[model samples]
Target: MGILALQGAFIEHTKMLHRLGVDSFEIRQKKDLLLPMDGIILPGGESTTMFKLLNDLDMTTTIKELIQNGLPTFGTCAGMLLLAKTVDNYHSDFLGTMNIAVKKNAYGRQLGSFRTTGTFASTQNVPFVFIRAPHVTEYGDTVEVLSIVNDKIVAVREHNQLATAFHPELTTDTSIHQYFIDMCQQ
Candidate 1:
């Protein structure tokens, strides 16, 4: 597994994957993309900065190619924004591979961050940490709603791509990570 280490809460994702006995490394530079990876995690952070850094390192094209070519991807928060086909009131050249329309920080600002135990599809009552989360307001025909909280879509899966508006790594939950691992194995 590979975690985009340009910025954000990537370390937590690294630790979460480690707990699941999954080996993961950081993708900080364009050369890092050369490494063999079964899947990639785009952790929560500042999307604009991450996008800028990706272009500065000239890594966006290769990463997008990898994801577009059917590599499994799990994006959380800002990662969701990057993977989104359209982010309301925002634009960038990041990985717009997922066929979902995301509302930028749909849950509001950092002060609005909160936590809740919600149903994530079959994985019922999973712990969700919403820190300036961006719930999927709409998705294409192929996209599946994996979870929802207060009627807001928090998790979605589209083909080989998976995205969550909340941070699963911030909590003790390992099922979400396991779900992504299963995706990689498939």
Candidate 2:
């Protein structure tokens, strides 16, 4: 597995994957993309900055092609924003491969951040850490809604792509990551 280490809580993800006995590497520069990867994880962080870095490092097109070509990908928080096809009023899409519309910081800014337990896929009591998280406003029919909080969409899966507005890596629960790993195994 390859985790984008350009920005955000990437270290936490690495630790989590390690605890799960999953060997993972970080994609820090363009050359790192050349390495073989069964899946990719876009960790939570500043979406705009990560996007700019992806472009500045000349890795945008290559990463997009990998994902578009059926790479199993898991995105969390700001990572979700990067994968979204539309981000409400924001112009330009990052990967824009996933057919979903999201509202960035929908739960308000950092001051509005909070924690909660909710259903995520077949798992119950999944702890979710939301820090300026985005919520899905719209999605294509091919997208499967995985979890919702207070009527707002928080998780969804579409083919090889899996996205969540919450930071699962921030908690002890490994259900979300395990789900992504299962996806990679398939």
Candidate 3:
């Protein structure tokens, strides 16, 4: 697995992958994209900054193409914003591979951050940590809604793409990460 380490809680994800005994590396520049990777993780962080860095580093196209070509991917929080086709406050899309419309900061700002347990897919009582998270307002027919909180869409799976508005990496639970790994294996 290759984790985007440009910003956000990437280290937490690294630790989670490690706990699962999965070898992982960080993708920091265009050259890093050449490395073999069965899957990728876009960590939660500032969407705008990460987008800017991706473009500035000339890695935007390559990474986008990889995901579009069926590279198993898991994105959290701002990472979800990056994969979304339409973001509420943004004029344009980022990556735009996942057919989902997201409302940026739907849970309010950082001060509004909180933790809760929610039902995720077939899993029960999954830990969800939301921090300036963006919830899905709409999704395409192929998209599978996995989890919802307070009536807001917080998790979904579309083909090889898995996204969540909450930070599963921030919690001790490895089920979500394991789910992503399972996607990669297939």
Which candidate comes out best when scored by lDDT? 2
88: Cα error in model 3, Å: 1.4
User: Could you estimate the TM-score for every candidate?
Assistant: 0.97, 0.99, 0.98
Tens-place lDDT digits, model 2, residues 89-185? 6887688989999999999889999999999998999999999999999999999999999999999999999999999999989999999999999
Q: What are the per-residue Cα lDDT tens digits for candidate 3 across 1-186?
A: 999999999999999999999999999999998899999999999999999999999999999999998999999998999999999877865888899999999978889999999988899999999999999999999999999999999999999999999999999999999999999999
Ranking by lDDT: 2, 3, 1
lDDT per residue for candidate 1 within 1-186, as digits (tens), equals 999999999999999999989999999999998899999999999999999999999998999999989999999999999999988767655678999988887777889999899887697879999998887878999999999899888899999999999999999999999999999999
Off by over 4 Å in 2: none
| Prediction RMSDs, each to the true structure | 0.9, 0.6, 0.7
- lDDT score, candidate 2, position 172: 89
lDDT of each: 0.91, 0.95, 0.95
Candidate 3 colliding pairs: none
* Backbone clashes counted, model 1: 0
Residue-level error in angstroms, candidate 2, position 76: 0.3
